[model samples]
Target: MRDIALLAILLWIIFEAFRRPWIGILGWTWVSIMNPHQLSWALRTMPFAAAIGGATLLGVLVTRGRRDYSQSREGVVLILFMMWISITLPFSMVYDDSFELWKRVMKIDVMILLALVLLHSKRHVMLLAWVLVISIGFYGIKGGAFTIATGGSYRVWGPENTYIEGNNEVALAVVMVIPLMRFLQLQMQAKWGKLLLTMCMVLMASAALGSHSRGALLAIAAMTLVMWWRGKNKFVTAVGMVVVAGALLSLMPAEWWERMNTIKTYQQDDSALGRINAWWMAWNLAKANFFGGGFMIWVPQTFAIYAPDPLDVHAAHSIYFMVLGEQGFVGLILFVTLFTMTWFTAGSLRRQGARQPETKWLSELGGMLQVCLAGYAVGGAFLSLSYWDLPYNLMILAVLGRRWLDRKEWLKEKPEPVIALPAWLRNWFRKKPRPQALP
Candidate 1:
């Protein structure tokens, strides 16, 4: 049954890719809704590896035919850095498990390539927004049903699925989608279409609260503030403020309130002290192994050396800490470089849009991309989510790339010959078209 379903999905993806490549971009969305947990596991191991391997093969075949290497210098640098990380790691420590690291590297590489290809048109951007609305709405309804059936506290899908419990990572992903959805809402002409988008916003906001992630809550608050500051619409600003205030009041539970109020207690609590100790241990290890300790090694080593019982040890809570401990300074630098490139690219696109206001679609796309990147930057501080988190984060990156590509295509144009029209039509009915100028 699973094989058959997988085959069906692969076929659908191929068909969509041929007919509308943007639609194929929703491959992750489909994966997320149908079986988020399994997809998450697949992202971590074999499934993602196979998917990436296939994407690489497809890229090879396509490139062979087209022979276009118009990749940016920053792209080349990023790819080279990824390759360096893969090769530099000490695979000899556990040669049998080396494939795991390679799989992770390949998955990230595949996502970048996929994003670049899928984002080459405007239609793809619209398709991505549609998928976000549909998938998130489905999950929201599912969560609501579960909540209703088992009272407010009981999760419908149980602990097996992180999203079922309204996981912080999932909340962060939804928050990232907000700007794109808001942009779509602005562009959409139909009344029902706007309504659907408004509902999506509400549903996503609700799900974010359901997850009870303090970090995600903080991130969403920050994102809302940024959006309000950047947005020109006074009505949207006012509505957003009210919605945010209401969401906070309605969603926060007594326990959550207590936790927030006592967050400073972490400094004194045993669990908090443990995290501090873990950070100290991670710092010492990172200092000793300046290059890297190899992927997934630092935690186990720290557990063995520092903790009285090795069984109790787990990952360092902070993403930066995890990167430092596992991948070392070199890996950390590469990670920073990747994020920096993404930020710079998004910012550049926004500036280009601002300069060329006549290109409305391009300007909107750039603005949305900037907002999403900002949200990710804020979210990453709390969550260890990287390209490896799969389906969700990877999918978000792919959609952002697709939107940018669409804007790029929109910017490209040829000069049209000027034509004289009938005096009556030109003077009374038809508006004169503005002269086309390249930005």
Candidate 2:
């Protein structure tokens, strides 16, 4: 029954990709329901993601006719270099589990491919938006429930027992959806449809606040400011203001407010001191290794050197530090280049799209992608969400790329005249009409 339900969900997602109603349905069920425990469990044991990938590949093969295997582009080149750095560490270092590293790398690769294949049309883009909104909304609801149940204390969920780390990535994802939702609202005419979209936006904003992530708060603020600036209307301005104000108020919970008041004092304390020490340690390790310390090297090294209690220590909190320590300057360059190109490409596309109203959806998508990518980049400054998280993000990039290509093709195609009549009516003058008398 569970398997059937999962399969049903997957089919619904595919059908929704073509039809678009899935966005509302998914937002209500997945996001509003606020459950991640079940999802986490399924992700751990089932090949749900793999099935999605397989289906995508099959569709691509049938439609496009044969896979195109070519030399690596700048993106693929950077990924390869990063993978190489991961496996070729000079010595037995911290967290040096090559197999685990390979597994993560493969997952990222698969996600990129799946995203590229699935997001091939406007319909697909719409479906992707729905999925993201629904998933993030669900995550937010779950986190909110946990926060409430624990009375604002710490909480974690799932079998892995991962803490609800309250990271900004959740907020980042939600903020990206805002512009797209707003675009849909502008295009839609139905009062109920508009109301539903507005509610989803509220849920997303609420989730961002509930996450209690400082970076998320900051990213959402930045995006909201940009949206307001571009809006050029009182209604949009009002909505943007409300979202910003709500997000700001939510960030100042009593405990969090107190912590902010003592920010300077906290920075001078043991927690901050430890992070500084870790940064220094990571920097020195990178300088010594040059090429890399190997994938999974940081954990064991930290354990061997810094662990007074061995079992308590973990990897460096910052993605930059993690890459520098484990993969060195060379790997860092590749990672940075990959992300930098993506940013530039998305930005350039947005600029070009602004002139073509017909391509507004693509332009909005580009902007959304840029903000989400920026959020990831900023988040990377503090935490390492690059490995497992990279694929989902890259997939979005691929989708954007596909949309740009399709738009170009559309521009090159001849335009058809808009008419109210069907094909049969257009050819009516050439055909005989004998049924009028009988009727």
Taken over the whole model, the C-alpha lDDT of each candidate is: 0.56, 0.54
Question: Whose lDDT is greatest here?
Answer: 1
lDDT of 2 by residue, 42-85 (tens): 53355434444444444454554323233224447555765666
Q: After superposition, how far is residue 235 of candidate 1 from its true place, in Å?
A: 8.5
What's the lDDT for candidate 1?
Answer: 0.56
Model 2 scores worst on lDDT over the 10 consecutive residues at 155-164
Model 1 TM: 0.74
What TM-score do all the candidates reach, one by one? 0.74, 0.71
